[model samples]
Target: MLELNFATSMNDAMSDTMIKENPFSSQPTTSAFTEESTYQAVCKSAVASAIFAVLGLSAFLAQMFMLLPILGIVFALLALKAIRAYPDELVGKGAAKFGLLLSAVCLIGSGAMHSFIYATEVPEGYRRISFAELKPSSRGTDAQGFPKRAAELDGEKVFIKGYVRPPSGKQYGLKSFIMVGDFGDCCFGGDPAITDVVAIKIQSDDTVNYGYGLRRIGGTFRLNPSTAASDEEEIPRVFYEIEADHVR
Candidate 1:
């Protein structure tokens, strides 16, 4: 009878041990190791940092769209929080910090660049000229005439009105040039094409879906005429074109 009692006691002890060892026991699984939480935090930080870095860069390039950096900074702060909470993920933490630093640098650089660009006065040689004053039928009456006019009006800041014409193919669809003169079948008996057009070279992010119509661009007049045939496609000859401080 004593042997039987001993055996029963031993069995009860073993059962209790087994229950404690089981993962499904009452004890919380996450109570022991925090590796899972650390991994999650690291992932979050890395993603946030990458996002901020991209946004900050975008804002810096497009002076008009300056709000991108502000949002980037906000995201960077979130990334910093995640990194601080999970120091075990040192790589992620470092990335987040770097992103924040980059954002700050880009923001400051963008502001400085914008101030410098806008504050600089138009050179006396690059003043604005009125398109109405240009005589299309005169002796200098060629595609190059407008550009010469631009050079003459260099310091005389003026506003020019024109329409945006879409390019031919799908690949060139995004490229639209500003036409200073009329846009019917022909302008002054010349073919109505973008050949003599002033290419606006808008940034990729700028909206280009505005319908073809009269739009005014105001900026310091600058002449960028190209004599080389190969360089013709890249830069237009007559740049009565505005460096566009404002487009209305």
Candidate 2:
């Protein structure tokens, strides 16, 4: 009986030890090494940067599209910053770098090309002029409030670049159109400031298609002959008009 009791106690102690060291025990355990999640999310800004970079390829087409690459550069910087701030949770540093590189290339290359064109675009006999030169005189009321610069250039062959203001549901095969220096002034729905607008009449039976990019025109700059007056105000028909001999 004593032997049986001793064996029983020994077995109980062994069972208790086994229970304490059991590998498959149901009790909660703390691992010395915790596993990390392998999945990482791409930064949204990084993705946007890449997308903008792709769209920025169009920057070569026109200067207006240069904004795409500029936005891409901004978004790429933001993405890189976010990825650095959240190292473990966010990825896409490579994508951000790619976006940055492509955007830089597009911006620099297109900018250089546009600058070159701007430098050499005027015809040999045409004088390069800007919209700023056409502003009315601030000091004197001479030339019907026209600036001296504009009056000097009157009937002179001048080369100017401007955006075509879309017409009111009439854009196809146009012989004439309104021009503005700033893109924001384009109004299909409303008229821009009278002084800021130019009436362009295609000469030599030439016609122009509707477009939004800068149009390089070599023309005879002139003041409108019409000084038609409304009941309340005197209004000159367009502040300026271009008798365009060359359009491109």
Candidate 3:
């Protein structure tokens, strides 16, 4: 009887412990919930880093603002730390790796872009001029209404800023192309006025890739009355042309 009582007591204790644990219950434990939250945070960081990396590589958008790549790299590192901390709970390991790669690429690209922009510095003794000032007025537009400053710039070495459009659809190392004042309008297929565009002819046989943002070009300025030829309806062919000596 004593032996049977001891066995019964041990069975009762085991049953009580099992009841408390409640393996059949569907509710998640506090630890499980905490782990899920951690996983989500890790994924969010990874995704954010990836997005920023892509933005950093964007043509003009990232070029003007250098922070995108830096932030992307930072976030990617954070994501990696989180994933390593909770490997069992956190997902998106692949995403974190991809984010890191993209951020690195953008960082490299941004550096190159900065170097290029600095290289295109305007030479001393060149007067700065706007595209609007360079264009002579058409019949519908009055040349007298335009700024007299453009006339003064004629036959002078001038420095101008504009966005480049590759005539050959080449993104890098353009030997010849057109420049426009507004990048937003150009991207949306909006044609700029004749005065707002300039034909750029690079004399160097060594081609340079299209620069991001507003590029400063220094060269000889000439005013001539001629109609521009364009295969695209959105682009006007009539405008002032610049014989570019140096482009940055």
Candidate 4:
């Protein structure tokens, strides 16, 4: 009878030991070692998520890096998964979610901005010209000012990119405005030279928001006779104007 009792006590102790050591057991006796490993993974994930957030925000600096925001979002998602898998041992779930949110925002905002800038594809067959293409010389009506190539573009449907002078009111969809090579030269402070300016007349009811930026304008090009005065000198101003159809 004593031997039987000793054997039973030994079996009970062994069963308890097995239960404590079994990691998958319903009643787990978790150790500091397992928790430490999980915490380390959580830390790594959190740091990765933070890195993603920074990259996503800075992605706007270069058009080629537009995919960075998506990459950041992916990293944040992986971090969240790590946190979820070791909920009892790991932390930073909140951080991971916040990182994901920031990444998504950056991605969407960057996409919208790109669309705004590039949506207007310069229509095919439209002649492209620049202020320098006018070949403006020191004086108006100089042969150099109206090059042969520029004269050929006159009366043709052409596209030009430049800044517009803001009207008196912050108007949208202006019917007419002065187009200039440099905003500071015409509207802000300095007197605008004739060759540096073009008068734009819009035919379509396209509402152009008055602001400062390089905007593409499409219209029928013309050489109009316009003049300006400085110190009682009838300074020759811009001889170019456009019957604008589109301004964006």
Candidate maximizing TM-score: 2
* Pairs of residues at least 3 apart in sequence or in different chains that clash in candidate 4: 173-207, 173-208, 194-237, 194-238
lDDT of 1 by residue, 137-222 (tens): 34354455543444566545555656554333332334335554555521233344333444444434443444444555555554
Off by over 4 Å in 2: 1-39, 81-86, 137-143, 187-190, 228-236
In candidate 4, position 203 carries an lDDT of 89
lDDT string, candidate 3, 194-247, tens digits:
677777777756455665456777778765545556433456574466778877
Candidate 3 accuracy as TM-score: 0.53
Q: For model 4, how does the per-residue alpha-carbon lDDT over 142-184 read when each residue is reduced to its tens digit?
A: 3544656556777899888787766555457677777777757
- The lDDT of each candidate is 0.54, 0.81, 0.70, 0.70
Positional deviation of residue 114's Cα in model 1 after best superposition, in angstroms: 3.1
| Best-fitting candidate, scored by lDDT | 2
TM-score of each: 0.43, 0.75, 0.53, 0.45
RMSD, one per candidate, in order: 12.7, 5.7, 7.5, 11.2
lDDT of 2 by residue, 94-147 (tens): 999999999999999999998999888999999998887777656454546667
Descending-TM-score candidate ranking: 2, 3, 4, 1
In angstroms, the error of model 2 at 225 is 5.3
